[model samples]
Target: MSVFRYTLLASVVLPAALSTVPALAQQAPFPADAGESDGADTIIVTGRVQRLYRAEQTTVGKAAEDPMNIPQSVQVINSELFTDQGARDATDIYRNISGVSFFSYAGVTFRGFRQDQSFYDGQRGNPFIGFSVPQLFNIERVEVLKGPAGLFFGPGSPGGIINYVSKTPSDTSSLRMVATGGNYDRVGISAEATGPVDADGIITYRVGGFYEAMDPYRRNTTNKAKIADGAIAIRTNEGGKLTLQATIYDNYLRANRLRGVLVDDAGNFLTDIRWNANEPTDFLHLKSQAYQARYETSVGDRVTFDAGVRYFDAREAQKYHEPRGLDPANPDLVRREFRDQIRPVHGLSFMTNATARVDLLGMEHKFQAGADWYDEKNVLDSRILRTGVTSLSLSNPVYGGAAEGDAARAALLPFTTTDTRTKRQGVYLQDQISLTRSLLLVGGVRYDHFEDKVTTSTGGAVSNRSSYRDGDVTLRTGLIFKPLPDISTYVSWSQSFEPQAAASQDANAGGPFAPVTGNQVEGGVKTQLFEGRLQANLAAYRIVRRNILQVDPSLPPVNGVDQLAPIGEVTSKGFEVDLAADITPDWVLLVNYGYNDTRITGTVAGQAITNAVGDRFANAPRHKVGFWTRYQFPVLDAAFAFGGEHVSSRISLSGQSVQPYTIFDASITKGLGFAELLLRVDNIFDKVYAASGFSAQSGHFPGEPRTFLAELRVRF
Candidate 1:
């Protein structure tokens, strides 16, 4: 079906279903006069508890299930935890998660693998496209599901998936306003309000927006963003609910897409940490619009159904001076090249699922079945201009001397213009069976079909056209044993697959490359201690990935073009511990630690320059530790929070070594009845470290320096 028809069907079916609510109410699936709360209840609670940082249930698996019983490594970071830390973007909350670290903008290294795709409300799509970071103003919580999730989320990186849960309209009427100011001339204001629109309380609405601008710590750089979000919910008398949501985002960055500070071969800094190579006119801009519709209902006392549709459109344009390397003849100067890129993307997705509870042969079972479809088109128009005379000095830098204006653009060389389309569809089934009171078995399987088509042109003439189509089946199974009501142990196995991009294929190969596949085995234990006020999870896992595409060194080049082959394999083994506890009524703490070891176990015999046996994966740290604790003083209505993170040294993709670093942060909060004030400081020690790096020549990204922020929030 066409995207328009699918959207039209959803728009028509929702109101039609609501019209039948009166007739369905006659059946009375739920007791009308019981005076007991049903599943759907909107109640806002004030104050804090031990569970404030811990989420008991999650929808990441396409159903509402307890994380302790899922037999996998799952973690959640709620708004309360990040809000207290003065978080401005998604990366600020990564320290609370285990086995996760920064890779680049809006990207992370997950369990020794790199992934950028994120799910919104359990649907597959990303609104924050290339180089754009996700803002946290409209998010309710962030959930991370570790290991392969192909059985539920479809083809993706084998590492795992990140899900963003949005704040929806509530029946409870409330208004919240916040004003914030920070170092580097940063300032922002936002307001959010939700309430019922009708006297009967059947219709509800939520609206929020924020605008912020700042000068970053880096020299000659600036950042600005504007966002608006709105949502509406309608409830039927029979307990069915329909919701519609819309969001718009505009972001601008000037001289902010920095490659990093230059470094020497021995990993020593060659320049100041805040040094930048981009010109004042260099900028990156992105604009996006997204819309979604969701409907949920219960078929009977033992069954529930959910369906959702989402459409997104985004455009990103960037112009920057990319640092190449040190000049061959003059080591004191760095060579540079100019790049211009324009990318536009459109995406549509649909998802539906149903869960049923049944009993067979004296054993209880929970079964779920779902199907999903996603379509996206991405277009890229890029150009580059290179000149030997464009260089920057190491000791003294000068700007406005490089190429600019229409004349420079007209002299630029066309790199490539390509239009790519991807379509994916999947169906999955899962069952959770209880054989006895202490033992449970869970199993699931999924079938997915993926298609990719790319068209490339140069000077308005078609240069190359490539198409790929393939299908695969992924499986998952787990067994859980409960020794006590508060303790559980489980083991699981899962598989995943991801198709290679068209651009990665060699034009001389004349055949589509095989998709990469991965599988993992894991075991874990979960416990609740201290009268259920503390939750702890420990897990160990090993993953193997095969069929990696690489250049074929054995075969001679076909007309000076390299040949491609799939003869690479990698293995990653790791363990993690996550803990959340409330030592006392006024004290809450969160701690996590991770140990990962990733290496290339197999590769082509002749390929020694890039992939080699026993080589460590890039950006995969072997050890990581994080901790945060907050203490509240009831007498003064105030709180104090302290947290920090430490990451072990890592290797860059180019075999360059990066040093380890530790950072500390603290915050203070004062409650004033209807208002609250917060003061936070990051990098308290002003430590200098490299967050990540591609190579010593291109530069290494530097960690933020000491910074301070103050915020005032009023609620009514």
Candidate 2:
């Protein structure tokens, strides 16, 4: 279906469904459940009266399991923490997670590797694609799963995965409205409501939407977004439940796809941080609609089954100017080029799983078996047109020189059109066995078959076509030993696989390459100190990636053409520490630190090409530290929060050095009966630093300067 049609249908259907539900009186707050269990009769009670910075369980493993029970490094940041901190998008919460940093728009440098894909409710497929950032209006929590997760998620980076758990329908009835205003002409409003559809509480519904508009810190840049989300749940007499959810997003960004400011060879900015190379008319736009349905039921007393299906359709387009290089005649002038691109993506995901609890021999086991399938088709059309005014001064600024309107587009030539399709299917089985009261074993194995095809055409004529099909088996095994009830020490080993391009630029020289594979060994200790008031986790790991494709340095060029080979290897070793403490009834603190070392380990031996064997990975910082603390004053009915992050120096992909920097933020919240007000200030010191860099020509992305935001929330 078209984006407009789907949006219109959802707009009509959601309100009609909600209108049928009768409103009820507000209910008192209750203990929040972490999530659904894996058919096991284990109940983990956190005993939290109010929202805390710590999370006890996660569903990233296809079930709700305590973080201590899982051997891998896992962390969760809930809605309360991000909301209190005044987070604007998903990237704003990265500081709470160890070993993570921004790579670009929606991507992150995770454990020395780049990761861009995200999961929703433990399912694969992300609606927010390309350069778009995901809004947090409908998110309940963000879960970070470190290391390889190939046992469940097929074809992914070896570093980790991020899961966005959405807010679902609840039995409690409530209405909330929020108004926000901030510096830079920022304004936003949102409303959310949830309640039961009938007096018997057999059906429930939730609907929410938000509209935001802002002019960013960058010159000639503006952002606006509108999002709508709705969900409905129906419970059967037999305890079976079905949930349906829909989301619509419309986003527009003007001159927001900037390549940052011009920089010299020494990484010094030659222009102001807010400098813009593109015209005010340049924009990036995205429109998306996603729908999902899930059904869960129990059989007998030990068996449970759940199934879900998700469909996502999105269109993303951008018109931007890119810096090519400095003019040879005049070093003070930079050459620019303009391009327009249109991308459309369609994705479908279906998953079903069953969990059974049984006692075999003298051991108790929780067994889970599942199968999942995903399919996606993405198409991109690109057009490039160069105007007479393609150079801009570095010291002085000028705008509105680029060509505009249909006349310019009509004269443009088609650069490239690429159509790519991907299909993946995997079946997995896992078992959590208890050998003794003090020892536990968790093991899983998955077999995945992946197929990818790419077709490239220029000027409506096919240029190159390539297809790849592969199947592999990945494994996960972890052993946990508990010496005390509150302390656990564990070791784990996991494997992952990712598909690579099947062909090289010279199709005849290098026809195909093998898929990349990675394995990691990790050991960690988890402790619940002071009667579960404090949670601490420490982990050390080493990951090795093989079958990496690189330019063949050992082989001479055939027909004056370079070929590619899969004979490269890389390694990443790191240690991380995360701590969360509810120091007192009115105070909470969170701290995380990460140290990583990533280097190329193996490559072809004749001559160096691209990078040396011992070179470190670009954009991977060696040290990172983050902390946040909040204290409430009961007498004043107010709370104050402070947070900061520090990142060490790093190298960019083009061999340029990146400077280290630190930034701080603060916020204050006051309670006023049924309403609450919050004031937040970010980058209080107005530190000038680069978040990341692309190249000397493109320069580095500048961090946001000092900003202020105020929000008021009312509930009824």
Number of the top-ranking candidate, with lDDT as the measure:
1
After superposition of all CA atoms, the RMSD between model 2 and the true structure is 9.1
> For residue 572, what is the lDDT in candidate 2?
93
Error of 1 at 357 (Å): 0.7
> What TM-score against the true fold does each predicted structure earn?
0.91, 0.91
Clashes in predicted model 1: 0
RMSD of each: 11.3, 9.1
Model 1: lowest-lDDT 10 consecutive positions? 28-37
List model 1 lDDT by residue over 1-716, tens digit each.
24422432332234323333333212212222211112233111224543547676899898888887788899988888777788888889888889998877888888988888999998976889989989889999998999999999999887889999989998978787899877788889999999999998899999999888889888789999999999999996476899999999999999887787777655566877877878888889999998999998886678889999999999998888888888899988888888888899999999999999999989989999999999999999887776543688877888776444522663466657899999999999999998898899999999999999999997678898888888999999999999987888999999999988776665675246778998999999998876567888999999998888777787787877787787788898999999888766656688999999988887866564242223777778888899987766545666667789999988776667778889987776777665777777788778888887667568778889877777888777
lDDT of 2 by residue, 1-716 (tens): 24422332332233224323223211333235422121232211122213456677887887667888898998888887766788879879988889999877898889998888999887877888889988889999999899999987878999999999889898978777889887788899999999899998899999999999999988789999999999999997486899999999999999887786767656677878888877788899999998999898888878888899999999998888778768899988888878788899989999998889899999989898999999999999887765554687777767774445522663467668899999999999999998998899999999999888899999889998888887899999999999998899999999999988655534556755667899999999999877676889999999999988777766787777687787788899999999888666556688999999988888766534232223777678999999987665545565667789999988766777778889987776776655677777778778888887667778887889877777888766
Clashes of 2: 0
